[model samples]
Target: MKTFISSLLLLFSFNTFAAPKSELWSYWNVSNEKNATTISHQYWQQTLDKYLITRGEFTLFDYAHVTDADERTLNSYLRQMSRIDPREYKKSEQYAYWVNLYNALTVKLILMDYPIESITKLGGLFSFGPWDEEIITVAGKALTLNDIEHRILRPIWNDPRTHYAVNCASLGCPNLQPKAFTARNSDKLLDKAATEFINSDKGVLIKEENVQLSSIYDWFAIDFGSQQQLFEHLKKYRPELKPFKGDIRYDYNWKLNQQ
Candidate 1:
């Protein structure tokens, strides 16, 4: 009986709380055509420029060497972001705002608990990760990392490419770009991110008759629409990647993408 109960608890934590789907936080659905203000991400960019290192297929952040001044810069950027209501800006501008903020918050989270092997370790005995913890307050709402990614960005944007823009601070996730996202260059950034991730073995590796994909597709299957759609999405990035009738596999790395 104890064994069964333990198993149930594990399942409850991993299966129920781990993956959150895209549901529109309807309050953020509004956008302003009048607001053409370009929000500056220079502070966030400065941190990335100073600490992000491109290592082979993925990038690692040097969380250990972050100076006190730079950490203050990160926190200042987060504070500036949280004060503004995204609904007051155009969706294009809002996209970059939310993406940059999400990535910055994730990096800060890892820094708070530096020296950890995996983010899963921060989840304690029964939780999957720190994703559920309210890490930032934005527009008067206390939001979690999951809330930023799954709620605001995913639903408002309705673009699968969004998965590439927000970094999860994991080796298996998309590369954390050296430059912070911006309104003027966000679309281009998305396409570039998709291309880079798709071409890399971490995203898709075609071995003879089999196609191996990152678990992002499997986890966010709803975003990709279907298996056929996923294949099409892959081909969009890598034109040389011909469709195969072989088995498809999904895998991911949960280790902290730390330097």
Candidate 2:
């Protein structure tokens, strides 16, 4: 009976779901830098400037007040993003492009189905989340949020800070910065975002004698390295976490990060 139950549990787990394959990882040469026109993220910056609201360490979007103009501007930005070939630009530019695209697309999806409690509530049957759906086609290949993160950004850059940069439109996730990430300031922006998130309550909690952390660390454990590495990473951002040593728990809030 135990064996049967284990099999059933495995079948139901979202972790068992396979993602669609894409050539994004193999196609781009990260080391090669060719002179090319930089992709402009002006429309994304405008949309963010209009809707993003900062509250302490967390940032929320005024999803309820998103006007028709906002929608148009967001659509224009996505369209513009689709036209560019990531290979032409430098690696930093490509990194910023994918991060901005992932975030902007997330906001677009949330706005499309506004008034939802969480992004996980959207999408069709048996769809654990919208991350697997092909939301955009770039360079003749359809890309999903999962593809952009796992296959492209995370794998290509191998930077754990990438997790802090992409917003999932949830209170549990890191704040979506009010400014679009640019090649010129990607490093500073990523570092600042990591620091902000680590120090925020959403990232870590000390209750009684136990330590609780965001489920992000659990979900992307490989990306952040081992548990000890994660603790070290957290300490690097917030020195206050250094003294906490007890049973570790992880939690995440799926509530829409809205105003």
- Which stretches of candidate 1 lie above 4 Å from their native place? 1-18
Clash pairs (backbone) in predicted model 1: none
Per-residue accuracy of model 2 over 209-232 as CA lDDT, tens digit each: 788899888878877787788888
| Model 2: lDDT of residue 207 | 85
What value of lDDT does candidate 1 attain over all alpha carbons? 0.87
Candidate 2 least-lDDT 10 residues: 15-24
Q: Per-residue lDDT for 83 in model 1?
A: 87
Each model's lDDT comes to: 0.87, 0.84
Candidate 2 local distance difference test against the native: 0.84
Residue-level error in angstroms, candidate 1, position 92: 1.1
Using TM-score as the measure, the top candidate is 1
Per-residue lDDT over 35-77 for candidate 1, one digit per residue giving the tens place of the 0 to 100 score: 9798889999899889998888879999999999999999999
Candidate 2: residue 105 Cα off by (Å): 0.6
Q: Pick the candidate with the highest lDDT.
A: 1
